[model samples]
Target: MHNVHVITHPLVQHKLTLMRRKDASTNSFRRLLGELSTLMAYEVTRDMPLQDIEIETPLETMTAKVIDGKKLVLVSILRAGNGFLDGMLNVVPGARVGHIGLYRDPQTLQPVEYYFKMPSGMHERDVIVVDPMLATGNSAAAAVQRIRDMRPRSLKFVCLLAAPEGIATMQQAHPEVPIYTAAIDRELDAHGYILPGLGDAGDRIFGTK
Candidate 1:
C-alpha cells in the first residue's frame, strides 16, 4: 500500500522473472538475487542525506556531495536475509552490518527470535532491515520492533517479494517504517508462504532445498 514501494525498474523485473522460473538452477537463482539486490539498493537508498565537502581535484578544488557511509547500517534478518547482504554491501562497502535471527513456529506461524545483534550508536545510524521475503510479516515486525527499541535515526524494511497480507500486518504494527520490495505478490499460501514467490528464499539461496 501507501507505505510500500514496489520497484519497477526494468533490470529488477527482468532478473526477478528469471528467478521465478522453477527450472532455474540454484547458482543462477543466487546470482540473479545478488544482481537484483544491487539494483534495488539504488531505489532504497535514493533519499539518503548527503553533505557537501571540499575536495581537491587534479585541476581545481570543488565541493562534493557525499553520504556518511559510517552512519548507514544494514540489518539482515538471518539466513535468507543474509543473501541480501553481499549484494547490498557491494554497493555500500562502508556501511555497518547487523543481524537478527528469527524462525517461524510451524504451528503458530509466529516469529521467535533466537539471535539479535546491532552496531553501536543505533540512535544515530540509519538502518535498513533486509529480508528476502515479507511473507507472514511476523519476523520482520518483530525485528523492526527490536530495532525501534534502540531508537535508530531511521528504519526501513527491504525484501525481494512481499505478500499483501504481510504488508498489511506490518502497516498495522509499525506504520512509521516504510517497506521496499521488488514485487507485492497476490497473497500468502495456507502455510504462510507468499504465493508466486520464488520458493523459500533461504533454501534457494543456500541450496538447502
Candidate 2:
C-alpha cells in the first residue's frame, strides 16, 4: 500500500538480522531493538510538516526550518511497544507519551483493552502508535480504532516487523493511517506468529522467556 513504508536502511537490516538469531543475548536484543527503533523512527517521521522562520545564527540572520503544528503524541501499545518508545523519545524528547494496554484472547483472538490514557488535547496533536511486531493486526487495528475515537489530527503506526496478513488487515480496517515497519516477513504461522519474526516481541524485548 502507498501508505505503508518498509525501512530498508542497511544498518536497520543488519541489526534486525542480528536480533533474529536464537542465541542472541537479552542485552544484545535490547540494544539492537533500540538501534533499530532509531532508524525506523527516522523513516516514520520523514514526512512531518516543517515551517520556516527567521533566526539569527551568531553571524547573520537566516531562515530556519522547524516542525510545524503541534508536538507529537507517542502512544505505545504496552509492554512490547515500550521497547520502541525509548528510541523514538531519543529523537523527539519533547513529545508527550501515552500508553494503551491490550491483550488478545487465546481462543477468540479478539483484542481486549485493559488500559488507555492520553495527554490532554490529544485531538489537536499528531498521534504515532508504536509496537514491535504486527502479527494478526487485530491488536494494532483495534488500538488505532480506540485512538481514532479520540480524533487526533493525524495518525500513524510504527513497528519493527510485520506479517502480510497483519498489513492487509490493518489496511482494510484503517487505511487512512500509514504503517512504518522495518521489515515485512513472509507469512503468519498457524498460531498467528509472523514467519521469521523474532518470536514473541514482548518476550525478546523483556527477557521473560
Query: What does candidate 1's lDDT look like per residue over 51-134, in tens digits?
Result: 999999999999999999899999999989988998998888999999999999999999999999899999999999999999
Where model 1 places Cα greater than 4 Å from the true spot, the runs are none
Root-mean-square deviation per candidate: 0.7, 1.4
Tens digits of per-residue lDDT, candidate 2, 185-207, equal 99988888899888988998888
TM-score of each: 0.98, 0.95
Compared with the true structure, all predictions reach lDDT values of 0.94, 0.90
Location of the lowest summed lDDT over 10 successive residues in candidate 2:
66-75
Best by lDDT: 1
In terms of lDDT, model 1 sits at 0.94
